[model samples]
Target: MADQYAHSGEDKRPTETPAIRWEEPPEGPVLVLLDQTRLPAEEMELVCTDASALVEAIRSLAVRGAPLLGIAGAYGVALAAVRGFDVDEAAAALAGARPTAVNLAVGVRRALGAYRAALAEGGDGRRAAEAALAAARALHREDAEASARMAGHGLALLDELLPAGGHRVLTHCNTGALVSGGEGTAFAVALAAHRAGRLRRLWVDETRPLLQGARLTAYEAARSGMAYTLLTDNAAGSLFAAGEVDAVLIGADRIAADGSVANKVGSYPLAVLARYHHVPFIVVAPVTTVDPDTPDGASIEVEQRAGHEVTEITAPQASVAGAGGGIAVAPLGTQAYNPAFDVTPPELVTAIVTEEGVVSPVTSEALAELCARARRTTAR
Candidate 1:
């Protein structure tokens, strides 16, 4: 069993407990992740001694979210290199651990590239390992900065789209401090609005199959003292019908060249409803999430998960483990098609907000330009 740690103090900030962190102890370097699977109930830390352990955590959704996954991937590479393991193998495994999130692969490649470059420059294993660690730290720092910038851009867009002061934002999944190096993607924007005293309410969707919003987002919101309400995933349409939602904010796992967004499953329905309700449906993500290689929504590979995740209720507090795990919520021999994510085409998106800027009327050309601008800025 992974070791558990309770919050040190009550006065700590809502986001004080970092979702992912790295520590160098006497033994060696270990990547420490705040076990997300046990969150909102128990505060636990999963210490990963190697890339394999980290890979398992990633697969288990113990430390997830698009931006955070990228950070973890980079750190996993650094861990392997620093520990004198096969850097190439570790990078390949981390990158392929989870598909759909382009950031994870991007981060792994960056760290591996740095390590190889150091070797090419006649550096020894230790030096190359240091280079990889530096790359990972740089990516982590950059992601935090990107999160802050995205919040500003997203909040500004929110203000412009809904000039009315008191904004009521609806969000899906668990985009918050748990998801990024900084506050988060869509949830960060809502946090900014709340901090600015312009937010009236935040409606959180209970993301099914895992209930990330109900368990994670609600925990963060409550800690932050934000006015929020949690509703079942299917209850979102009723909220939209009642004109309770002013805008819909969501974070993306991957964004294709044509501005297609692949987010947590059930996001597509929200987009469709947002369009029908004439509400602004915005996607907030960092530029790193945009994948020019994935040409369109059709090309974005959605990961299919085990059917047991749907048929069983895996709560951290559940005492008796059923056949599949937790309590069996479905009958035996029931089969389920559980896709981890769903794609939302560009046409349904009102705007794509990134640290670089917002892309209203999302287009392939505009997304490419945004990615280009971000690269140029990074080069500088």
Candidate 2:
């Protein structure tokens, strides 16, 4: 059994795996990620002692997910300052690692803002580091709460849309305990439904290039004792064709002002499939995933990945160097185009569930009203 931790032992989370880490870090500004590459097997932390190392972790996906990346980036700045590296250089390096990730930029800018303010006040590096860590922790706490609220709102929407007793939801990539500060974004909602006796079975897409769903998400489902089955990315269409899915719930990397969501590669295709199958396609993410400044999907830059992810499939549990334990699924020397994420148009998106509530379609007026209502609720 995966080691269990205690929260309030709250009814909100009624699973063997409690909410992941509700306490603050013992050491300030250190990046500790549950090494995701190893799942359904070993749970390990990739602890970083410095900024550059943290950057490598993000680049290598030792740590990932937009919200998690934001938290890690903030800590990276703090780590840089703590280790005597120039804060500006740290911000530059961290922000430059992933160009398309809005969270990375948000985290870097937040830390940079704190560092500048502290410098202006003639504070030492220690105090500045403390401030940076404080920002990251605040983000972390807020994200956890957002996860809960989003799950509630999303589950409600699911109940209304499907109105069926048992729901089989299709999701791509890993968006669960390993992806966020807590339960997760999309999977959190599905897990919520499971707790409420609504979830039938979860369809885990073996996300290609990384297999996050096959490896990480499935591990979480198994631990939580949720009925889950994993299949290759290509098999999702078959499931939808057979009417196995009632809805599609996935987390977003970024949502433009026009509500064009960017998620893991192959998400756009699922959106198309859902539309054809008359399934309710929904996106569940925190308010942090939205970028009001970015106008549309056309403006969101899609990141191209390395050829290796396409050329070979490594055993998720293999530790040996050059382990062919995973087969070479793709042809050798064939140039491959791998975009880290694909943009889903608003027209295809059925609704967007945030911590506040569900937003209908994608429109400036509707989203603004939804956001305003959310702010009012938060204020209370």
Tell me, by lDDT, which candidate is best: 1
lDDT score of residue 280 within candidate 1: 97
- Worst 10-residue lDDT window for candidate 2 reads 1-10
| TM-scores of the candidates in the order shown | 0.98, 0.88
Clashing pairs in 1: none
lDDT (CA) per prediction: 0.91, 0.78
Compose the digit string of candidate 2's lDDT tens values, residues 203-305.
Answer: 9998988888887788778767799899889999999999899999999998888889999998999999999999999998877678878889999988888
lDDT of 2 at 136: 68
lDDT of 1: 0.91
